[model samples]
Target: MSERKMCKFYNLNVPDRRSGSGDGGALNHTGNEDDDRNEDEGIQPYVPPHEHKLEYSYWMWFSQRPPTRDLSTTTTGYGQALRMVGRMGSVEQWWGLYSHLSRPDELPPLSNLHLFKLGIKPMWEDPANVNGGKWVVRLRKSQTGRAWEELCMAMLGEQFMVGPELCGIVLSVRFQEDHLAVWHRTATDLAAAARVRDAMKRILQLPSTVNLEYKVHKDCLRATNRHEEEMNHRS
Candidate 1:
């Protein structure tokens, strides 16, 4: 069965739209007031006893590339090393988690923040993602935080109209450039893919000058594997 059909059959819940909400856009390493405020803005995170439930539960995963590791071997260990930051089923819970976490700018190089639906792991080999691909937007270092925040808000708000086709989103932190990618269920569905791409561009307020690309999971895996092979040969 197609991924979309399967999702509908199971009645998987994505994020719900927040009515009449404006996007307010995250880090800190110090103990000073400025650092404290910057990290969480003094908003204490609270979990409700039994109210304000979200449409779906989500998991947040964090990973940082290991130093001196070969790219091919990286996936295995990297996947293993991913730490589950938290799981939330409500807006309060998400806010609590988001408030305490380090901002994307404060993250170390090669770090990544992944927010995927509760049951799906953020990996190319995962069943939900194996048949999928990502719509990636390259951004300058200065632009990463706002774009990430906007994208996250949009996802949690269910602003993207493609039903079931949307899987998750990722923000990758790099040395010189950062990337934000939207994962979807099928690479072969050009129409759905186009809609998703357009939604992302519109929701994220991406300018025409920004660089965006759609890459199938298989092709992405191939490219990484090829790079790993080259690195191994050089060693």
Candidate 2:
């Protein structure tokens, strides 16, 4: 069936009345024609026919490394490259977008996928995220796609029990190592942050031997700016 028709059918099967900023709010909904389709799932023949509802809607954003004259310039322009790929308030909507899009493994090196609550931008500059920080877990390239999928599912299902402090989740694909991080709204709320960290560890099934780092958004922004300055000086 055509994607549009399939969505209509799914929506008809399960009507939803719960409203949130993401469900009724303005969104960018832009996307590319190419889709990634079950590449990581060994070519599944069937996709479930039921619709699922999430607590809140989310927006998907994508970014890729930018081209530069110098091969070693490393000017990814991640912020500038980021663009809204789509928005999903319901299970059918999410599946429609995710099923067709390229997986993290299929994306180009240095690409990123950000899924943030609707009405909130994925950037640290967003008002909801400015004072926040992210709990990060670095993973080998081979481990990223499945880990990312599980993380997204967990967040959407509200499995973390992290409360309203949960902002979003990001998957950064790099040449050396990929990363999966969950953003929360406060850096100083150690108690809340600890709860979030523990929930994250449990949901992701990380071992006690693994270490996760939480970086404040302000610190990340500062480091980014400093790197830009150094690159400009060398240029």
Give each model's whole-structure lDDT: 0.68, 0.68
Residue by residue across 1-235, what tens digits does model 1's lDDT show?
2222211211222121122322211121123523333343222223356646656566676766656665325467667656544456677666766766667777777778898776677888888888999999889899888899989877777788776778889999888899999998899999989988898999878788876898999887777777777776898
TM for every model, in the order presented, reads 0.73, 0.72
Q: What is the C-alpha RMSD of each candidate to the true structure, in Å?
A: 12.6, 9.3
Clashing pairs in model 1, backbone N/Cα/C closer than 3 A = none
List residue ranges in candidate 1 displaced over 4 A.
1-50, 69-74, 225-235
Model 2, 1-235: lDDT tens digits are: 2333322322222222122221321122222223221111111112234546567877777765544523222324554555555566667667666776666776666667788887677777788899999999999888888889889888888887876889999998888899899999999999878988898888878899999998999887787777777878988
Q: How good is model 2 by TM-score?
A: 0.72
lDDT (0-100) at residue 214 of candidate 2? Answer: 89
Measured by lDDT, the strongest candidate is 1
